[model samples]
Structures are given as structure tokens and as C-alpha cells.
Target chain A: MMGLNKKDTSLFVVVIVLALLAPFFLNPFPTDSSMAQFNAGYPDLMQRFVIFGIFAVGFNILFGLTGYLSFGHAAFLGVGSYAAVWIFKLLTYNVLPAIMLSVIMAGIFALLIGYVSLRRSGIYFSILTLAFAQMSFALAYSVLSNPKFNLTNGETGLQVYANDPQWLHRDSLPDLPHLFGLSMRSTYEMTVGGWSFSFNTGYYLCAVILILTFYLSIRLFRSPFGMMLRAVKSNQQRMNYTGLNSRPYTLAAFVISGMYAGLAGGLLAAMDPLAGAERMQWTASGEVVLMTILGGAGTLIGPILGAGFIKYFENIFSKINDNILHQWFAFMPDGIEDFIVAVIHPFIGKGWHLTLGLMFMMVVIFLPGGLVEGGQRLARLLRRKKSDESPSADTKPAE
Target chain B: MGILEIKNVGKRFGGLQALSDVNLSVQENSVHAIIGPNGAGKSTLLNCLVGKLIPDTGSVTFQGQSLLGRHPHEINQMGVARVFQTPEIFGDLDVMENVMIPCFARRDGSFRMHAFETVMNEKELVEKAEQILIDVNMIDKRHMHSASLSRGDKRRLEMAMCLVQEPKLLLLDEPTAGMARADTNNTIDLLKEIKEKRDITMAIIEHDMHVVFSLAERITVLAQGTPLVEETPENIKGHPKVREAYLGEAQV
Candidate 1:
């Protein structure tokens, strides 16, 4: 809202209102119905909607503005998750310590990676980042491995036992710390008829922070710093000869994006009491790049929507089974239902990636600016058609 | 004492000698021009002065301080600003925003920091940037993106960006090289106006004799990376060595 245009400001307000009212609205759906399975309002997937949204939004700060395509940003995300988990083990299982550690760790990691990677520009820089991230992933897998109990636990992940103390988690403890030590985690449960909604304390906390981060990102996007970043992307030589050094500005943006990734990683562990090194994989890093490109890189809110869309499809489509497919096509004869299942089965199940890949290719090729431009084009086309039919009616501007 | 002094500066790049025993001294506030042929190393000398390249021998001193090992931005902070031959401006930034970068650099000093302060709310920075924009005749186009401006206007904006830094010495490397005759005249006028308003030293490299004769109080000529002559423009026009190296046949 701070720097948003009229349309974006309204859209942001609508999103916040929807996130708040989702539980109430979803409460009417049947408890055991398959439709409920598709509801993104569920805590596990809903948390991810905001978490990866933060990741993509942060990544936009670097690749979107500076044109520095980093292939190893996932390493920072993984570092953040590891730092957050370590905080859970040593300090309090509270979300605050985890978030703080994650940010600091990510910043340090970015500083190190940025110092070296920034030495080279363009494709070489991207390769440097990728090599560093792969090294990190390998180190995490081998060095942190345990013979008996896993430290990082490798691909299996490290989960916090309930016996572990949640220092600032109020719901987990009756007599939590007071005032300065007041717990931020507060859960409220509500039931309507046969439906129950577990309003998570952590989810709201993450949503509030994500909103704040989003607002900060918007400010960064519009500020002089943002202008400098865009200039660097446009022409580094021009910036250099203008008596400005491009390195420091690009580095600052990189560090800030890394901090945001760290914040997201910390939130992930907070929502679920586990941290996995798998989160830092190259593929995981590539996913955010895909999300940004598919949603329209450089446009605000596009990346977030892209994150939500990808996560939603991944969750919903992966859950589709033969039985569900057959049930949906049951209106046809039994043989027809079986035949339809056979055709749609591979595309929906294990083959979900092929569908996403095809969609990504189409979006990249046809709508290079992503869904945002696509939507704008559609709106313009419809308006043009209407204007042609009634020319005088379109005299006034749409704004 | 000369504010900027280059004593016996020489540089070699492997097999090629770019500059050899080149000595230049600029009095505190004078407009000095360097005229040279294609490979005479005028730009190489300028690069040494601004710390883009270090000389193989001799010392470059500005305000009695060595500029040998300092970074270009640091050299700029030391009050030496350079304008490229081509208009070097932040294309994505507006005219005023283009002017504001030097203000931020001069005010903040450090190139990169997580200041996290309201960059636009810096009152002094905004006022200085606006004032400079007015000086450059770009006040009306303050909100226009620099890339969209005409070539002349882009050059003006770049000049304004350097001027706002309030450098003790300004360097222009072939400022009007690609400009049309009209644009070249406008650029000369802009430089004249800026010189009248600011107390500054200037070292300029130019191929155009008309622009150089009109603006430069004193001129230095170079041939094959070695100084041919340094004299007043009137004397330079008549000097035998300067004429032989550059102007002899052209003045026919």
C-alpha cells in the first residue's frame, strides 16, 4: 500500500481480506469431501503459499532488478533452514530465535558467496553461484551426516521431538514467559457443524511478516536504490562512467534478497517443527526462478501469485488418484470411466511435472511477461471490442 | 603549486608503450585541453589520473595527495570527476534521479551501505540535485527518463551529474566526438557556462579544433604518447612543434 498504484493497492487489500476470511469460508465445505482436499486454506499448504512467496519475492530483488541470474540462491534458503533448526535445538523452539538466526546466517552466507561470485559478471557469475551451492549441498550431506542419529539427517530431515522445550511457544506450555518474554504463538480453534478449523498461531505470524516484507520489497522496487539496480542491469559501463561504482549497489541488493530467503526458510521450520537440507537443492532453487518467470519477473505481486499457483497445482494434482478420476467421469458408462482414467491418469499422477512443464513453456513462449501481461492483454482486448460497438461509451478513461 | 600535477608518468602494456615520460600540471582553476592523434594515449593519461590504470613510472598527485592506488570512485570522492565521450547516463533513471546519484555518493561517501533511510526524504540531496538540473537546462525534463532524452539533452544531464559532485577538477574525454555541429556548439556553450559558474580545473581531450580553439584557454598537444607542446591557444596555433605534430597541414 505504501507505493502501490490504485489497482495494486486494492488488489493487496483484497488479498489480505481473503487470507483472513478463508477459514470462515472454507468451514462450510464437507469435512471428508474430496473438495476439501483441494482447499488451499489447509495449514500445511497455506503456510507454503506464503513461505515460497517470500522466497520468490526476495529472488526478484536480484534477478528481477539487477539481471543477475543466480542459480544457487537455494543454497542460502537451505542455510537459513539449517540455522533456524539449530536455533530450535539450542535456544528456544520459539519462532523468533529461528527467524533471527536464519536472517543472520543467510546474510553471512550471501556475503561470502557474493564477494566471490560478484567478481565475475553474466553467465560466469551464475556458474560461480551454482558451483558454490552444490559444494554447500554436498558438505551438508556428508559432513553433517551421523552414523547413529542424523545431525542434518541428510535427505531424511531433522525433526524436533515434542520433549524439546518451546521457549516462547505459549500453547505448548501453560506458564510461558511474561511481558518481555510473552509468547507470540497463540492458537484459536473454531468448529461449525461437522467442520473444524485449526487457526494456527504461527501461520498468522508468518502472514503478518510476509506482508511487511512484501511492503518493504515494493519500497525497494521504487526507491533510488531500486533505480540504481535497474541502471546496473541496463548498462554497467554507463553507470561506471557516470562516477558510480556498480559493484556495491548490486551486492547490497543480493544481501537483502538473501535475508528475505532466510526469513522464509525460518518460517518453514516454524510452521512444521523440522528442517531439511533437501530444501536447499538446486531444483528447489530453480523452482523459485520458474515461479518468478511464470508470474512475470519485475512485476509486483506476480511472483507471489506465481508461488501460490505452482504450490496449489503441486499439492492438488499430486493427490489425484485413479479412484478420484474414475469418480469424476462416473457420469459416463463404466467402460468409458475406465478409459478416461487410463487417458487422464498419467497426466495427473506421477506425470504432474509434464503438465507443469508444458504450462511453463506455453507461458514463457506466448506470454513472456507472464500471467500479469496476459491478464492485461485480455482486459484490453475485451475493452477494445466493447469500445468499437459503442464508441461514445468508451470516451472516458478506465482509470 | 599546481592543484593537479602529473610528473614523468609512463605506462607500458606488455610490448606497447601507451605513455612515456608525460608531465602535466594544471593550475588551480584553468581550462586545459589535450589534443592528440588516434593512438597518442590521451585517454590512457586520463585513466591514470582517475585511477582506472596505474602508470608504470612517475606519480599523479591531486591536492598534494597521490592518486596511484585509489579506486575510481575514491578518486572521484577526492574531487576529480570524469565525463565520457559518449553520454554516460543511467537510462532507467529520470533526469533528476540521474543528478541525485552524485549527491548520494558525495553525501554518503561510501559506495555501498544498507542505509535503510528514506533516500527521497534526504532534503539536502533533493535540493542539490534539483539545483544542478536547473543549471543543466534540464529542469523541465526532470521527471523524464534519461534514455528518452535527445542526445544533446543526455549529454547535458551527464554534465549536470558531474557538476553536482562539485569536483575540484573535471575531465572530459572527447565530449563532442559524435555530436552534430549544432549539438557540438550547444555542448561548448554548456561547458563555457559551467566554467563561468564554478571555480574548477579541467583537463579535456578533443579532436575538434573549432571547439578546442573556442573554449580552451591553454592547450597541450600529444603525438605517439609523448607531449609535443603545451602553450596558450594563440601561441599553440603558431608554434612550429604543435603545428608539425597536429595542425600544420590542417591549418592550410
Candidate 2:
């Protein structure tokens, strides 16, 4: 089905189902309930989920398959955002062209960086990539944003101002980033008694692209090219001696992944119409790496899960302020409530990274295969317990 | 001229000359074995032929084409498959995948984008890989990880990977180098069967006289980066130059 084997087909379907019904799945708590603070069905947060999901998925194609840890992947994402915002400023506010150009620009950037960076392997390659990304950050942050040729517009970021030359802009068209007249921020709020779900058009568009990219990723994973990438990771000497060029194969993976990051960057701009130099920061790259590792690096759906996992925590968990904590603990005795709030203060809201870091470390130490491995282990354990009556129900080797 | 011709291939590394004033020819369809004592530059000569090292003095050609200055993959693309001293199969891949990769290399010529098509959907390549595995007697262990395979099986898998490419010239750098006596015999038998079943030329570097005498149709005794004698295996055993090259280590 869809060029995938039965196992992959089911996985693809699961992603589609989850992505399409995210508003419901993410908004399980009632809108009026105290737990509604944790709900992530808002248009802004939902867009971030699918956008970052694309970024991590692309990053995995390089880091996961070929075992090339690119420390500057966020540069591609930043470049994509800048390219996208430039399109919005020069052309119309339409997202299609912006997304396309962002991908192409990112690919070209990847080619240049990968060509030089891939000459060295292991930690050297990583450092090379990091250097390139930092250079890109410097270029966007100051060098390219001068008054004579204001491309990135310095630290203020590049956004569609009232006096910009949007050649395709018209009275009939939406003033914001959109597909035709359908604005990305356009959301349909649905209320079911005390429960509320927000279905945003922008989120849906990003979700569809995410699904398409996910399918393409699956195809690439199963194709001969994918096998060759794995071969590269395993042993380059064997690959070269077998009459296969490993350099071009790795370059291709790097470029494809770069394009994915760019597409994600374009989506981010489309959602908010702003491209900042901070997107190109090294911390952003590290965050994606953490996401990939936390969710499972090599598995097909692991990156998407990882991206969503991190984004959800970043948005929802970080919103838990002292006021909200105190409100929740108001029902308790005064002394006990204050003690509990004080104890939990460091892991909530502003200290959300502390929570995230602790979880990431735990996942790394215990579930080295990431969240997907944890799921598989749980599934196996359940199956074993269910079939304990039959002593012959031994564990099967992984296919 | 033979299919592979080497003329005055001298290679120097800093002060030491690894291979100097070497010349030899491996004819088509003949198993030519180059035997020598340790540090006799046997491996260096093989490396020169496969473009792993560039000779300081002369020419190395396969099928009338020069092998100098070419990359390893480029050398491989010109119908030369090399088996390393230790089996260099793709350890991370499965047994089937280890064989299939060479087929892809042979068909695609180094790099081709299979971004859309699935690996299993490549029916002809899959069939070819399967057939090669069967020939190597590894079809039963096709699903096993190549790394987990026994040492003998790794050698066989490496052979399958090379053979699937259908190269005209096969280079084995001590193919039976760290094997049990029984496994060595099995490899010898496998090589014999491969020689009988296919139209291929082999250039083998060996320390083991048993393997050299059994498989080599023409034997070249190399000593101090030079070939002292090139003759039939029978004549090579009797040659005094062969004994002198071996420093009286010859039990022939």
C-alpha cells in the first residue's frame, strides 16, 4: 500500500490519523477545567508541532541514516525562514512560492556546506557543520543586514511592513500569509459542551505537508538509496570497494534533509510572517538533535514523535506559572500547599528546560533507542504476559 | 598483452620503498597467485592494482586501461572487485543486503537515485542477489545479520558481494588468511567451484603455500618488491629462486 510494506503502511496511517485528529487528541481536557492550561490545540502551537516535525524528520535522514551528526542543521531552517519571508516581502503573501523557494535555497546552501563539511567524518564533520552554521548566523545577524543591502534587516527581523514592495499583493487577497485567500491563522473553533477544539487552516496545511514528507521519507528509507546510506554508515570501505560512491550519496542525504528543514522554516514564516536570525542559533540545532534522540533516531516516525514531544512540553509545561501552581494547590492545607509549590517551582514554567533535560537524560540512559523502543518493549512485555500460559511463546527476532 | 599488466610499479613511503621495480601480467581466466615472505611487498602490489596506492615508477593496467590515479570506486567500476585480507562485507546490513549492494553498484555505476522505487521492488537485482547467495551457499542465512555470522560465513558473504558485481578480474588479498584449516579448505573449494562456474580472472596474494599450490595455475614468487620467478605451480615449487626468496622457509 502506497509503495510501503504492511508494517510501514500501518505506521504511515497511524501518523496520518494522529496528525488529522490532533485537535481532539491534544485537547482532551475540558476548556473550563484547570487542566486546560496544558491543552495544545491552539493554532500557534499546533503549527509549531508540524513545522518542527518536518525539521526533525529531515535531520534524521542525515544523522539517523548515515550517522552524520550535522551540528548546523538549524542554519538551513533559518535560511528557509529568511528566504520565505523575503518572498512574502517581494512577491505576494502567498505561501506556496515562499515554501518552494525556501526549499530550493536550503538545498543550495546544504550543497555548499555538505560539499566542504563531508570531506571530514566523525567529530570533525560535526565541527565543520557547526562552523558553517555559526558563519551563517553571523551573516544573517549583521553582515548581510546592512543599510545599503538590507536582506535580513538585522536583529529587528524581516517582516512584511506597510510600505514594502509586495508586487502581487491586491485588495482581494488576504494581507497575511495564505494559500489563495485562506489565511494560515484562520481557525474554526468547535465547542462540545465544556470541551473546545480549535481547527486551524494553517495547522492543516502544515499537517498535510508533514504527511507528504513523511511518506517520502518512508520511501527513501526503503529504497536502494536508503540502503546505500545505511551501507555508508556501516562501512564506507566496503561500499567504495563494491563500486559505490559514498560521497555523492551522503551529499544527497544532506541536501534532502536541508530541504526538509527549509520547508519547515517556510511554514513557520507562513504561520507568523516573521523571520528572525535567532532561528539559525546553535541551540535550535541542539534542540532538534535532542528531539531526534529522545524520540528514537533511526526509526521512521521517531523524529516526528520527538518533535511533538518537545514542542508540547515547551508550550504547555512552560505555561505553568506560580499562580497556576498555587491555584491547583489551594484545596490543600496552607503549609503543605506552599511547600509543594516551592518544591515543584524549579521544574515548571521558566524552568521547563530542567524538566525536559531530566527526561532526555533518562531516555538516553534507559531507552537508548528512544521513545519508540520503549513502546516496542512495552508491547513485547504485554504480549509475553498474555501468552505466558503457552511456554513456547518465545520472543521472535526483529525483522 | 594479458588482461592485467604491471610494469615497473615502484611505490615509496618516506625513506622506505614499499614496492620497487615490480612487473607482472595476469592473463584472462587464470588464477595467478603472488606469494612471498612477510614485508615482501605482496599486499602493496595488490593495493597498487586496486588504486589504493599509486606506484612511484610505472603503469598498472586492467583490460588495457590504466589503473593509476583512479579512486577506489572508480577502479572498482572498471570490472575489478577486491576482497580484503580480512573479510570487508557490510557488517551492519543483513546477509542478503550485503550481496545486493554490489548488484546495485554494478547496475547503477556508483550513484543512482532510487528515491521513489523500493528495494524489494527491484525484482531483477533481488533475484540476482538471491542467486549469488545460493551459489555461495549463504541463501539459508540470508536473513541473519552479516556481523553475527561465523568467520567462514563472513568470507563467503564477502565473496558473494564481489561475485554479484560480475567482475572480470577478482583480487583476493589473502582470502584464507585467518581461517581454520577446515574453513581454509572450504574457501579453496568455493574458489575452485567459482572458477569452474564463471569466466573470471583471479589475482591472489597468499602466505599459505597449501592454498597457493591448490588454486594458482601460474605462481609468481615475489621477494624484496620484485618477482623472481613466474611459472606453473609445479615449476614454482622446484625453483631454487623460490627457496632463496623464502629464506629456506620453503617446506615444498
Candidate 3:
């Protein structure tokens, strides 16, 4: 309530409830059922959902509020991941320090990049960010992978080894990333009848972080700074004449979003304890953009929904092979089933990217407000219909 | 010395000389009007005053400080506010928000990190913005999106935005460029009321003789990127060079 009005407070509560109940909601299908393949309650995938949700939320701060699309957010995320891994190797296996270090490191990187990139706006700003991210990726891949430094560890990725210093680590504890003694990989499973739900310590940690960041995002969206950023998006010219210097506002938003990406990246490494240079690649940046836009750029919940939708399709849809398709279509006539499979084949499996593109196109064309707008429209229509019928019936009784 | 002084100001855009040897001085607490035909460099000169463009020659001094090389927002902080030919209110914000931005600037200087502060909770700013809205006769439409306002209301809102800042020097670029006669009259009345209520200096550029003759205490006529005459309204109306510039012929 500090920054949120009633509506925003309700939205925040709804997000908290949804996140807390995700293990049950996402794993609705029974383990023995054929539909279990679609279940997203597993530790790894659930962790990704929350992690990328954090990524998109951070991205929306800059893109949604200020309308400054930086195509290099993944660089911050990658730096965050690398920082977390280094903390694991030298400091300790405890994730709190690693995550803290990652966020700070990422903020520093973002400050440097935002300072230079914010000088030129529109497409020029985007290009500058893109160039900086590419340079970071190249440096991480080759230049930082020398025998003298070996910072990123080249293509094989950077991971904690048994021989690393880990000066703060105790010999009595397990060599995995943890919060004190609680292992990130620890899980608790519950079974009821034929259904089972497994909740991971790591996934819950990510979920809790995601919820906090989401709340912070809501606060940012409703704050005066948020209004200034929107003003920057609306008309920078008017802002200047109104006696506002837009550069510092835009730069702050950029750095804040970058820190969010870094937190997400740190979480990624905290879950798996590895950092890859590919995480900083431009495609990863594009993927987060897609998540933000596909979910709805300006809305709070749209990005999380978009990220979940894409990751779900990527993991589950791609697992559907010809044999699985054939199994599903076994009841049909041979020729027709084969034809149906052929038509559906290209858009699923390895063609999930194509499906993602098609879905993105349709969303942009029809639901430009993303899924959130679509939901609002549908709710309005339903309310209109209900009100229309009730009012007509009441008028008939009066007549 | 006048509050704002322009000395030998000249600017060229490649082949076109926009303003050449344009010298002008705006006295404190006086209404000055800059009237000229198309491409007479009125806009070019105004742009120079506000830091939108740097003059090739001469310096623009406000309160004896050079306005050259200062950013637009810097000039604004130095008690100079500008209203564009077309209203430049923040289109995405509500009318109240549009007014409150300038109020924030007035209170907070050019920039401040009020990121965590709830705008709704800023009681002082809200009251200031609402008072300005009432003064501008837009209190009823405070919640409306600025872009959706009628042209007259948008112009009124822009004026309110500028007035909220309590700027020392208010530069208006054709404040009534496109308006119905009644709306233009309303704007004139509003400007008159503001001038009466505040010790503010105004420099207006206009093509409307009604607006210029009604509001300006002093008038400067620019012709072919040069100031042809600077005189009081009565003297400007009877000036031979002014009549020649408008009628395209010198009268005996």
C-alpha cells in the first residue's frame, strides 16, 4: 500500500496466491496419465518459469515505462550468472552472497552501458545497446577465456570445481549451492490418490524472489518516477520544456531493469551452479523482448504469462515426436491420420519457434494489449451480457 | 538593461539566413510582441532564446547571464518557460499530471529521484496543480487525458502548465495560431488576467493583429530576418516601415 492503490494491491495478492499454489495448479494432471507430459510442476521447468518471469519484469520497467527497447539485457543477465558462479568458486556455496554479488555487479555493468547508450535515443539507442551486448558476448566467449585469465572458461562454461578455494566453505557441508544448510535441490513430494505434486526448495526460492520483484515492479509502475518515465515515452520534447532532464530518468530505469535481469541470472546459476556465455547472446535478449511483448509490454502480469507460455511450449511441445503424434492419431484412418500428422508436424516439435512466431503475430495483430488486455475485454463482454439480461428481465417484470 | 537581451543574434541554415543582426531587448514586467510575415525568422530567433538552436553570431542573455550553450531545461530552471505554437502537453498523462510535472520541476529543480514517492500522496503538488487548473478554468476536466482535450482546452492547459512554474520570462510562439475567434478571445482574456495577477515578462510571436494590438505593451516588427522596428503599440501602428512591411509598399 506504500505505492500501490487498491487495484494494484489486489493484483499483487492475486500474483502471490498464484505463485504459492503453482505446484498444485501446474501439476493438475496425474502422473500415470498421458497428459502428464504437459505438467510444468517439475523443479527445473518451474525454476525457469519464475526466473524468466523475473527477467521479463525487469525488462518491462525500461521498455514499458520509458519505451526504450534495449536489445542487450541478456548481457546483464549473463554477467550476473558469471558473477554468481565466481562467488561459488572462490567465496562459498551459500547462494545469498552469490546473488547479492551478482545484482551489484550487474548494476555496475548496466550503469556503464546505460550511461553511453542513453545519449542517443530511439533506434540509435537500441543499436548502441545491441552493439555493447554483442561485444560483451564476444569478450566472454574468446577474449576472457585465455590461460592468463580464463574468466568465462570459453564454450564449456564456468562451473565450480572441487579444487576451487571456497574459503568460507565448511568441510562438513555438501559442495552444492545452498542457503546455509538447506540444499537448493532439496524437494518435498506429496501424493493424493493417483496425483503427485513435488515442490523444490530452489523453485520456491525463485518464486519468492519473483513475487518480491513483481511487487517492486508494481511500486515502480505506480511511483512518480514511473510517471516521469511514461512522460519520457510520451513526449521527451515536452518533458524538456517542462524543466525535466529526461536522461537521468531513462538511465535509472535502464539500470533498474538491468539489475532485475541480473537477479534473474544469479538465480539461474544458484539453481544449477553454472554460467554459459550463450546466456549473454543477442538471441537471449530477443527472447526476453518476445516474452515482454507477447505477454503485453505495459502490463505487470503479461510478461510472466508470456514467459511461461513460451517456455512451456518450448519444453513440452518440442517433446511431441512423430511417434507420439502417430500414437495420438492411431484411432483415425491410416491415410487421414498420416495427413493430419504431416500438417501439424512442422508447427510443433523442432518447429516450436515457428509456432511461437505465429502466436506472437496473432497476439500483435488481434490482442495488441497482450493476454491481459484480452482477459479484460472478455471480462467486460461477460459483464455486459449479464447486465443486459438482468436489466431486460427487470424491465419486463416492471412492464 | 532589459530582463532579456539579444545582441547581434544571427543564425544560418546552409543557404538560408534565418536571423541576421537581430537585436532586441525585453524589459522587465512588460508584454512584448514579435510580429513578422512568413520566414521572417521569428521562430529562429525564439529558438535561439530557448536554447533550441545556437546563433551563429551574438549572445542571448537572460538576467545578464548568457543563455547560449545552456540546455532547454536549464533555461527553464533559470525562470524562462516556453509555450509552443502547437500545445506540447504530455499526451499520455491526464490534465492534472501534465500540470503537476511543471510544478514538480518548480519545487524539485530540474531533476530529482522521487521514484518511490507516491504522486497522489504529494499533497502540496496536487493542490498547486489543482489551483492552476481552477485558474485556467479546466478544473472539471482535470482527470481527462490531455490528448483527448479540445484544441482550446489543450491551449488553456498548456498555459496553465507554463503559469504554474511562475516563470519570469514566458516565451509564446503564436499562442493563437489556430483557434476560433471566441477561443482566441478567451486566450487573450486569460493572458490579460495572468499579466494582471503576476509580475511576469512575456514575449509573444503572432500573425494575429488583434492579439498583438490587444496584448502587447511594446511591439517589434521583423522583416527579412532583421528587426525593422521596435516601438510602443501606438507608434508601431503608425510606423511607416511597419506599414510598408505589411502592405509591400512604402506610403508617403
Winning candidate number (DockQ):
2
Instruction: Name the TM-score of chain A in model 2.
Output: 0.97
Error of 1 at A119 (Å): 3.0
lDDT tens digits by residue: candidate 2, A179-261: 99898888899999999999999999999999999999999999989999999999999998988889999999999999999
Enumerate residue pairs that collide in model 3.
Answer: none
TM-score of 2: 0.96
DockQ of each: 0.30, 0.82, 0.77
Compared with the true structure, all predictions reach lDDT values of 0.81, 0.93, 0.93
lDDT of 1 by residue, B1-252 (tens): 788999999999999999999998888889999998888999999999988899999999999999999878778878988889888888867777788777877776746553344457778889999888888888999878779999999889888989998999999999999999999999999999989988988888999999999889888898888998989999988787876776456655
RMSD of each: 4.3, 2.1, 2.9
Please identify model 2 stretches exceeding 4 Å from their true place.
A323-343, A390-396, B248-252
**Residue A241 CA error for candidate 3 (Å)?**
0.8
DockQ of 3: 0.77
On the 0 to 100 scale, the lDDT of residue B188 in model 3 is 96
- Minimum summed lDDT over a 10-residue window in model 3 chain A is located at A390-399
lDDT tens digits, residues B205-228, model 3? 999999999999999999999999
Q: Give the lowest summed-lDDT range of ten residues in model 2 chain B.
A: B243-252
Candidate 3 TM-score over all chains jointly: 0.97
Report the C-alpha lDDT of model 1 over A1-399, residue by residue, as the tens digit: 365666757767766775666566534566777576665666677678888989999999998889899998888888888887776666566567778888999999999999899989999999999998888888777667777655687777766666766454555442321113433345567766767686766667767887878878877876768867877887776566555688888888889889888888878777665777778878988899998988888877778878887997898878888888877888999988888899888878677887899899999999998987788788888888898998876544443
